[model samples]
Target: MMNSLKHITCAFALAALLALPQFAPAAEAADQPQRPILSVDGRGTANTEPDMATVAVGITTYATDAGKAQNDNAWVAGEIQKAIAQLGIADKDIQTRNYSFRPTYRQDKGHENEINGYTVDNTVIVTVRDVKLTGKVIDAALSHGANEISSLDFSASNTQGVRKEALRSAVNDARDKANVIASALGKKIVGVQNVSESTGYLETRRFAGNMMLAMAKDVETPVAPGSLSLSANVHIDFILSD
Candidate 1:
């Protein structure tokens, strides 16, 4: 009777050990998932003419007295504002960006340590709707009291349409590249698994030199708002079908 009981316990233990391997496969299947077939990146570009421009203008005034410097700066700023108004620019379009007072530095003599004068700086930003009037507005600002011209940038006022076009181009580029790869591998593209898009901005540069700035001086300054190019990139993952 004792030998029979021991033999029965050993047989049950062997059966449990055989069943454990079957359960391991179910756990492994739950942990693992399918992976993608192919991945690629594509780029596209589109060019268009800019419709708007931004102008940065300013004045720098210096005097021995602090009050004099402040008065000069205020006067110049007023004149600049008047000029912008004369150009028919909206009041909201003109923005004051900076105002500051700094002591002028003198060097190279026995009195080099002394402060020579007080200087005041006032800067303004102006947005122009008409590209043709960009030069005219800049000239007007300078004639009024703006002595220094900082920067002029041009860009598209409405960029939504162009951005959509660029995105479409990028998608097409990705598809074309995937087709070529599939053909080389003797396989067909089944579908897209993932896609992502990125964009690039267009910028315009300003030239530096001595120029004339008088309201009555009606000589149109040759302003060339060059073409702007926007770019887009798309990363795609494609599944291959045999």
Candidate 2:
């Protein structure tokens, strides 16, 4: 009986020792301290002069015959295209933005259900590589039978450099904010755990309403290709240390 009791006691001790590894890791993890983290958002902007411009011009014509209306519109559109070409605009730079051919309804009581005439509208978007030639492009279009001007917008041809600068500025801003917050909490940023960024640029738009008036007065349409603002926003996860 004594020998059997000794063997039973030894077996119990061995079993307890074999089970220790499973629970040991959990206890060790519970005792370890967690690292601190700081999250911040930053924004930055860079301004640059516009190098390119886009102009949208339209031509409208009406006639009793649809064929005649379409023919007149095509003639005027061709003339405007030629005029734009004279100013050095390439064929690829000119694109038809919109075109429509529809019959107009007579508003008179007896003719209410009758078709009065056919109207044709043609709109084209012209990309001006030279910002200085924007006004000339508009004037050429108007002089060649373009009756409506929809929009004029300005942008920079090369924004990659500007965008990089803006991103750098945004990262610096985030670092500065993190340092401020960490310092107040009696801690310091040791490393960046993760970072994300988004970038965009805003275009400068010119009013098209006064363009015809300016042309009527026989003065050069004044255009200002103002500065473009490129912006970047960043979200950073900074590791903190005491």
Candidate 3:
């Protein structure tokens, strides 16, 4: 009877040990492997004519009297606002960028001296929704006492759509590159494990410095917003299988 009781106890202990395995932690029991991953970089580009432009127009008024300078600046700013409205630009699209009153300095002999004048600068940024009207808007601003054309930038009105398309193209390019590399190594692509993307636009414009702004007086300010290129670069890690 003692021998039979010991045998039954041993059998129950063995069964309990076997049942414990069913409750084991998944993270501890999962099969994991570390291996070299294939990384490929791909780039994609898409170009479209810019649909919108941002123009900075301002009046720089200088006079010996501070009150006169302030009054003149206000007058010119009003004219610019009126001109912008006449072109169908809504009030919301026109924004005041800068308003300042500062003393002017001039060269007196070999030293810099403070001139007897106060300069008032009033600037506004306007978004021109139509690309074809860029030149006309510039001309109108200049005629309306806008002495300083600070900057002109071209951009797309619907940037999100362009960015999405560029990203899709970049993904396709990365997959193609991975396929080529895998094909050369006699391995097939199993799956894409990870992907990252970097995207933006490059702006190249005609505005440079004070001299360029001065040169606008002689020319018709021929602005050629040829084509804006939106680009995307992607890095992908793809798992391969034999």
In candidate 2 the C-alpha lDDT for residue 182 amounts to: 96
Identify the superior model by TM-score, candidate 1 or candidate 3: 3
> Over the stretch 85-203, how does candidate 1's per-residue lDDT look in tens digits?
88888989888888889998788688787888899988888888888888888778766777776777788877777777888899889889889988998888888888888987665
Residue-wise C-alpha lDDT for candidate 3, range 4-96, written one tens digit per residue: 999999999999999887767665656545444689988888777788888888779999999999999989888888997898888988888
- Give the number of the best model, judged by TM-score: 2
Clashes in predicted model 1: 0
In candidate 1 the C-alpha lDDT for residue 239 amounts to 89
> What's model 1's lDDT at 193?
86
> Which candidate leads in lDDT?
2
- What is the TM-score of each predicted model, taking all chains together? 0.76, 0.81, 0.78
In order of listing, the candidates' clash counts read 0, 0, 0
Query: In model 2, which runs have C-alpha deviations exceeding 4 angstroms?
Result: 1-31, 201-218
* Ordering by TM-score: 2, 3, 1
Better of 1 and 2 by lDDT: 2
